[model samples]
Target: MKLAFPALSVALAALAGAHALRIESSEVAPPADIRGEHQELERVWSVFSAEPLEKLHLAVPGPVFVRYDSSLRPVVTPEAAPTRGSAAGSQDDDESVEVSAGSAAGAVKEAGSLGSEVKEAGSLGSDAKEAGSLDEAAQEAGSFEAGSFESDLLANVTSHSRRLRAHKKTQDDDKEDDESDAPEVLVARVVVTGNSSELLNMLELLALKKSSNNGLRFHLQNADATAEGFLLTQVQLAEQHVLRHLTTSLSSVVDVAPRVLVTNSSETKVKLAVQGASGLLVNEPEAITLRDLDVEISGSGFVQLNVSSVQLDGKLNVNLAGSGAIALHTPSINASEIKSSISGAGALVVEAENLTATEIVTAVYGVGVGSLRATTRGAAHKQKITIAGAGNVYAGSVVANRTKVEIWGSGEAYVQVKEKLDVSTAFSGNVFYVGDAPEDVRTSGYFFWRTPVQPAAEDKYETHAAIASPAVYPEHVSVQTKQARHSVDPIVKKISVGAQSVVLSSHLAAVAHGPNALLVFGCVAFGLVAVGMFAQSFQQRRARRHYRPLV
Candidate 1:
């Protein structure tokens, strides 16, 4: 909704109190104009200032989204006070912005120009010459008819006149005007209105400028203030679904934790990134690539990253709860690391070429919650995915050369590998191998299963096992199953077979040299029989010599 500056009653007391509102080197411009500059200023602003208005506030009870806009920033103004509206004009060179208030408004402090006060003080100091005449009158009267006591009084009067004259010179030495010390302050208000749902989302965009009312005013200060420094001081949210998309790039130093925030991204152009929890959603034609963003998304708001190009770099943290999910749809992802904590029943899914992380470390503690991806490019050097609780990971056609897949708790994990896959599962979850299964070497609770197409190998090796609790013993339960690839074509036919033996003729000739081997075996057999008879005779003699009876 288009909003206008409303008729707001400024607390005249605040502006005029002991600490008068003071603003220096800044002007109050139309706030609608500020929104247009947010996208244009991707670099540091040499000047800093603020714009304020009591415009319409959007109160949304749903979710809020922030995204970048390539379109021209619209220049709009809010409705002013009903009586006279607002008077907006600029100085002769258009370097100055001026706003005039109508009814129910307090006064605006203008730049100071001392007029009568300095002249009045100067006139008082000039009166010292008139006081000198009193000293002459006193001397004349005392000399003519006064007694000895009157002469002493005339001397005291002359001394008092000289001292009063010195006061004027002292005042002139320190003649700086007092009015120049205080800076001029611009007083204005920001008004927000909408349903609580809309306002919740809109509140994330609000920014305010705070200063001491008595501080000296600054002049020609750059008015490039950003909304990044906005503090989320007060937020009252109801149970409502609010969704919004906003993109902002600003340089603001945060003094307090903002109710909503996007932090400083120095020097590099942020291609596009979704560094939050819940979910990320974007479906632009020239999709924004995510890079160098750290966002933690909570609540039930889901974000989708459906951009044309996106990168996840730096340290990214994702937290999801309830029923919302964080989804990625076909985006180039290059991340240093992605750390996630999942609770409740939220799911994380990356479809097709939708997921890529150099190092992914995730923990899932909720029921049926997990991180699953169907396919990913093998651009990363190494990829690691770890799931805990009742969660698991599935890699349908991922092509990462160096990857590690791990699972914990009562959930199962099945992953397809192109190069190498090291898996470790604990508790009741079954570990299924997709392409190259592990060698049959038993450590503890893990068993290997071969694909159904390789049935002979599955039978040759132990395909399954009954987990044993040696403590409880002889009662055994059988466990074994054959896994088949999903939706595979059943038709197959042999193409060709070679009739020629592939072995080298030289190796066969080496065996031909052993023709005398049978003759050697016959001689060896005859020699063994003679040796056996001699041993038997010696054994009979030794038995007779050492014979004894048990009785």
Candidate 2:
């Protein structure tokens, strides 16, 4: 029984060795490839974390093997199988065969033992399969979760959002800067290309909104006296698209009303009307009207119609009509011709070098025409009328009736009278007898003649009065006469004579010579009588006069 026990022990030992070898060859060798595949799968999972699975598909060889290292368990290596021996002796051999059979049975039993291990390994494999299925499910779920997480992270990490936020901040800063940099609305400049009605309407609107103390004000360009304080109606303001402003250029045109209306503060509103080939109209308040009011007319072939007030710092060729007074201050009126009746309470001063008035009737304290003329009728009913021209006539009349006329010239003044006309001069003139006048009447400077007959011969001439120097004529003289129910008075005095001679005589008296000769003869006779009496008295008085009263 002791010997049998030893043999069974040896047999059991041999069976254990063979089982280990089988396990080592079958299970342990496969696990090496499995572990390596697991590492590769782990690397793939990391790659999927960054890039999409589809993108990694092209880089990887095949479907990646993923193995879960649950609990990080270590793999076991199976032991090698034991070797068999050859024996001799028939009986011994038979016994050895029995022993071997017993050993085989033992081996079978050992192999049976391996069945449990195999079953355990199969169970482990099943577990590994289940774990792999679970891992796949988790991986699938992780795909969605990772994708969602990546989307969320990307949304937050994107540069677009940051850039948008920065842009919004920049816009806010720009808005603040604009608000801070904006200037105050103290003055408003409006430019109008057309009429003044729109400007007037705008003014009315402004007036309605403005404070009573802060009234609207404006300045009219080249406004006449009659155009001051002109009133404008709403209708007029609407039809004209005139611009209104605080201040405007003077080169532009302004159409103002005949009267100017203002608020209680008496803030004058000025309107400007440009009347030229190319013109503009502007109406502005006086407060801000001091800026550049230069209105420039541009473009060729432009026509500007009737304008109320035009301040011309530029060229102008258009008609102007103002119901009010027109003030021309350094204004240039250039046109084919200018014809307008100017009437103003204020004086009219024309400082223009060239002015031609067809009919000028000025009623002012003073009127100055500098190289100007009234080609037609010019009446100056002012207190003083001064004509500085070399040829100027105060009156013109053609009739036998007597009329008072005053003419002044540095040259000669010719006066022709058809009827009995008396003329006096502080000068001298040549005399020629056309009618029946005696030689004495023709040769005298101061003489009285009535139907005097001219002598047939030139030698029968007589002298009335002669100057001592002859070269210098009297400076002060007068001529007056009353004949046939007529009285005449001279108007002009201190007449000057040049190299030309002048004649003076009444037409009726110049026809006869008896009256003039008789006056001269009577003066001579009286002179002789007085001289004889004076001589006789001197002689008698020397002989001692007696009682002359008794004789």
Candidate 3:
């Protein structure tokens, strides 16, 4: 009975060892299809393979939500490699390339007959298909009404593009149809029971993989938190579709940011949280509606994010906190508005042609710089800019229909406003106004003419400042007390002797096994200040013009 139990236990353990976490595919509607209008990522996998990953690159051709979670392992079974004898083509077998997962080319081979299959992709049938597709596109290009020429032309162009893509896919398949076929990779989503699962040795094999229909997606769980993040290459999407809910959070310990290229998507909104030192670059978007983008970094994590919008149906709200920089190129259109806030020492730069916001509120808690460059002739609505911060805000060319600027704090709001202006400054903050100032600019304790009065067109100071002549500092230094009339040598020697003695005593204490002797530092500092005053006095005495008294 004992022997039987041990045998049974061994068998069960073997069975458990054979199965681990299973990979599955959910019912995700992929982005625009090849024949449809979307391309999306709809699957995840922990494949089987014993190779190491050199690089990890996933390119999803649509808006993809990436996260890490447990449970729901989709079961999959890998297929055996197909033999060379399985080739059904009549062509010389020497030309057959064994296409495999490692190869960049692959296609599903369809059998034409039971005894023999059509595998000669370079044969006359493929040529006929290509010729037929071209003929159809050409026919589509011509069959259109005279009045609907532009619409028909667009349709024909899209048709031709699809055909060309299909043809290219065919050609790519032919290039690797005969390569030494590696092991066949096959996996289907299946229901599994129990919590235990096994992972395949597909580390390097899965790296830089291009997932079809699902585009390309990879998730990192708690088990993979220590592992390095991945990069995404080309994932192209069509118009009317936008890359949505794309959130990337980088570790503060990581030195490199994930490189992503998103362009021409109708409404692309990206939120990137860089915890450490990393940089991200977002080139252009057709119409971006960024909402509550919070980039909070603790360490010296520098993030460079550039977003451009041509149209907007939503507001742009960005909240930044950390030690880095974030800049934006807002839309030139007047319908959009932006709301931004900054904390911790992070720099923000905005370049826009028309910044006609309904209620623009910008605040900086820490010592960061917020700058805005606006260049527009006119705006329809009354633009209101409310700025409050302890940091500097340099807003250039606040030219609009009716501008209202309100500011407070120790920060400076350098602005140039046009039309009717309603200005308010408080808490000793400066409102350096250019162009014509409104009559009702309420001020308290804050300085309006804090800067020089000379103003230029468009509220910019264009002229260069002239250098001041010498002999400008004699009033303070020339007025010496009668007690000091004895000589400059005694006081100079006293200050130098005190400074040297303190420094020597501090060094001796440090040598005598003291823990950071900072006692003598104050004396040295005072002596240095006195020496600086004496030096300045000497320079002023030399620089002062000697006026001969009329005898």
Q: Which number leads on TM-score?
A: 3
lDDT ranking from best candidate downward: 3, 1, 2
TM-score of each: 0.37, 0.15, 0.38
Question: Which candidate do you rate higher for lDDT, 2 or 3?
Answer: 3
Per-residue CA lDDT of candidate 1, range 166-219, in tens? 676456433421222222223222222221221112132222234332111111
Give the lDDT of residue 255 in candidate 1. 13
lDDT of 3: 0.38
Name the 10 consecutive residues with the lowest summed lDDT in model 2.
52-61
Q: lDDT tens string, model 2, 1-551?
A: 01234444554465433212110001111122333211211110011011111100000001111111222222324342211222212323544343344433445443443324445455434554666643344456664354466545654554465567568867964553343233221111111111222221212112212322122222221111111111211111111222222121111122333212111121222223222111222222222211112221111111111222223222222112211122232212222222222111111222232322222221111111111122232222111112211222111111112211211111111212233333221112112222243212222121223222222232111111211111111111111212222312111111112222223343321212213322332344345445545655666687566545655
State the lDDT of candidate 3 residue by residue for 1-551, as single tens digits: 01234434443443232222223333322323332111122223433211111122221111122221223222434443344556434345534655453222222212121112222334344555666654355566775444476656756776777778779867765544443233322221111111111111111112222322222223221121111111121222211122233322221111111223233343544344443233334444444434333333332344444345434444556555655666655546333555666665666776666665544545555455666666663233344444444566665455444555555445556555555556555444555666666444443323433532223444431111221222111010000011123321111111011111111212111221332112232243245445545665665677564554556
Which window of 10 residues has the lowest lDDT sum in candidate 1? Answer: 248-257
Q: What is the lDDT of residue 278 in candidate 2?
A: 16
Ranking by TM-score: 3, 1, 2
